[model samples]
Target: MTPTLNGPPAPPADTRCDRIDRLRAALNRALRGKPGVVEYVLAGLLARGHLLLEDLPGLGKTTLAKAVAAAVGGTFARVQCTPDLLPGDITGFSVFNQKTREFEFQPGPVFAEVLLADEVNRTTPRTQSALLEAMAERQATVDNVRHPLAPTFFVIATQNPVEHHGTYPLPEAQLDRFALKLSVGYPDRADELDLLAGAIGDVSDARAGAPVLAPGDLADLQGRVARVAVQPNVRAYLVDLGRATRAHAGVTLGLSPRGLLIWQRVAQAWAFLKGRPFVTPDDVQEVARPVLGVRLGLAPDAARFVLDQILAGVPVPV
Candidate 1:
């Protein structure tokens, strides 16, 4: 059962909000002119979920991922996935030490607190599957030995939407692992001008400032998010929406039970971000699109239409 706010008290609201605001500022600095995208990204992180960024190259996806790592002051690792990439290359492998005459384990990028898998679909399915275990259970097993990853391990994977040749599409099972799929579109004219001006000033060469969050701060905030209450009626509203997805003719596969759970958690995080102690039906609707987009295997336009139908059909609880 999920915990309630009436249980143990969390950190003071003012303090948590200040830290979250600083984190938001840091992300805005990294990916200029996309506050909406940053909002969803922050919600996903607070929900302790992974992110899947699907867009064309050169859209600041890498910059956003790096900024997230820096904001939390965590170890960051990037994997440039390719067709020839091996599973062992990502999850590490056991090596025999000639001098010690014993096998030694070498950790891979998965061991980092934040991992960016660039061009994830470019890698073969075999190599992609290497991340499944690590993502789902926060552990990597090689040679029948299990290695635990960081407690706050987070992955921000990217894929090119327009490029399909020589790319392996992520199967539904793999897609279900992501909490939200986002696109960082082009910035506004003014923001782009600012970006150009900053570039001329060599802003890209500037190092990240002090982390917005200290060690263990993220996990503590996540715990607080989990305690954000979801009223019984709001939960019923979530269930109605999930069932609506299943019955929709446009949807081949609907939201799963795991997806429903994730939706609730994300709604809770959204409410917490809004400075609310409990969830409401509005919070559920606010996050429906991104949560369902990654799970439903439909074209973008059709997916939006189906989602619209589902949300419109469901009755919001008072």
Candidate 2:
């Protein structure tokens, strides 16, 4: 059974002053044995940006989103992206009333605290725009009506890279909006063995992933994340790192200013998760792949090359 969040059984092991550890426990419990994945996901959330997970089918992408949503204690919604989907299908339209002479705003699936957009690329570009708007701005403007989103609105959108028959590659602008993109690759031999042997009952339900922390807790966490210090040299190093992606001859597009901002936030979040108040070269090195790798790659090995170039040329910003 899921533990109730309304009242505490006792004082926390440590989060009375800081809640990152508590939040991590909640995610790790649901994501069991994938703490790195948990860190990457939380980094995006800490940065207050969206995430994209591209991998083969059945890597538990939906479950990951749901689990993370539960850990943060937010309302989660999943949208199965299909070819026939419409804008109204996602951002809900206002239908005119002849008698009343006014239209009412009908919210679609985008108004939740967390949204899992499954098979995101399967839908046409038009349909994808609805999500892109929410992912980028944290609000959806339909018929010139702007609807504010939840303070903790987060999107975990995924696509199957192996299958391209009906898929649409997310455009560069759209890809730029995601703070980070990751792959939930096939689980290691151990996790897979546990996965195969584990019963369905082992999976935690939405309510099971219930809020261990409240919205204010998240606000406090992000505030603490922002304060997780990055040294001047490290800031220079991060800039040089992102600049290198754009300057790479093979890269058609470079990481944007927005990407630079989000990645800096990501680096700080990463450091904070490790229980460090100050960021180090290791923090930058540890997160470069997940935060900037996929978003700035050229070809199959493009992203890896970008990281290599930065590491070799930048000398860790110290």
| Best candidate (score: TM-score) | 1
- Worst ten in a row by lDDT for model 1: 2-11
Cα lDDT of model 2 by residue, 247-301, tens digit: 8776767778887888888887777677666678888778777777556755547
Give lDDT tens digits, candidate 1, residues 3-112. 45456444355534788999999999989999999999999999988999999998898888889999999988999999999999999998999999999999999999
- How far is 174's C-alpha from truth in model 2 (Å)? 0.5
Per-model TM-score versus the true fold = 0.95, 0.87
Q: Clashes in each model (backbone N, CA, C under 3 Å)?
A: 0, 1
Clashing pairs in 2: 73-211
Off by over 4 Å in 1: 1-12, 203-208
Evaluate candidate 2 by giving its C-alpha RMSD to the native, one decimal. Answer: 6.7
